[model samples]
Target: MKTEDEWQHCLTPEQYDILRKKGTEAPFTGKLLHNKEKGKYICAACGMELFSSEAKFDSGTGWPSFFDANKENIATKRDLNHGMIRTEVLCKHCSSHLGHVFEDGPNPTGLRYCINSASLDFRK
Candidate 1:
């Protein structure tokens, strides 16, 4: 495990807040929110493959929406913050906060991975 100083040294403030402190970016304000590219979305903290371009879709939620995830790449836990029940998604390798997952999504998987762009890196 990395020390807080080490994580702070390598990660940006936004990334640290979102990934470590479980903060969220504003809706429709992410850099990759409208990205229609072909590549893999990797974890910013550990470079673990998280999502594929093919599974990405427009949820119109103003975040990076993916209907599916890479094999065993993420970990989820029940979150009861803000008087709402939600699943908090995290990087399986680094335990960094990636985003949340909801069941109201498109077919095949019916999952919406509303991810923060700062938590991911694209590799084309």
Candidate 2:
């Protein structure tokens, strides 16, 4: 876990907000929202491998959507924020917020990992 100071120093305000403070960026504004490259999406905070390019798909949700993730690199918990119940996905190593996973998704895993681009670093 990173101290508040460490997080502040390493992350930009936007990155810290989404990754540490659990905030969401506006839809359709994410850098990786339309990314079609072949690479891995890694945690911006800790460089942990989270999702593979092969698992990515255009869900049209304006976020970087993936049907599946590197399951072992992620951890989830029940979140009851905004008067709604959702499963919050976080980086397993750093516990930084990535986004939420939902059941409404494509084939294979049938899960949608709607992640914030600010929370990720794409390597192609």
Candidate 2 local lDDT, 32-59, one digit each (tens): 9888889999999999999999999999
State the local distance difference test value for candidate 1. Answer: 0.92
Pairs of colliding residues, candidate 2: none
Give the TM-score (vs. native) of candidate 2.
Answer: 0.98
Task: Show where candidate 2 strays beyond 4 Å.
Answer: none
Task: Point to the candidate with the largest TM-score.
Answer: 2
Global lDDT of each model? 0.92, 0.95
Candidate 1 clashing pairs?
Answer: none
Give the Å error, residue 51, model 1: 0.4
| Candidate 1 local lDDT, 17-48, one digit each (tens) | 99899999898988888888899999999899
Question: TM-scores of the models, in the given order?
Answer: 0.97, 0.98
Model 2, CA-based lDDT: 0.95
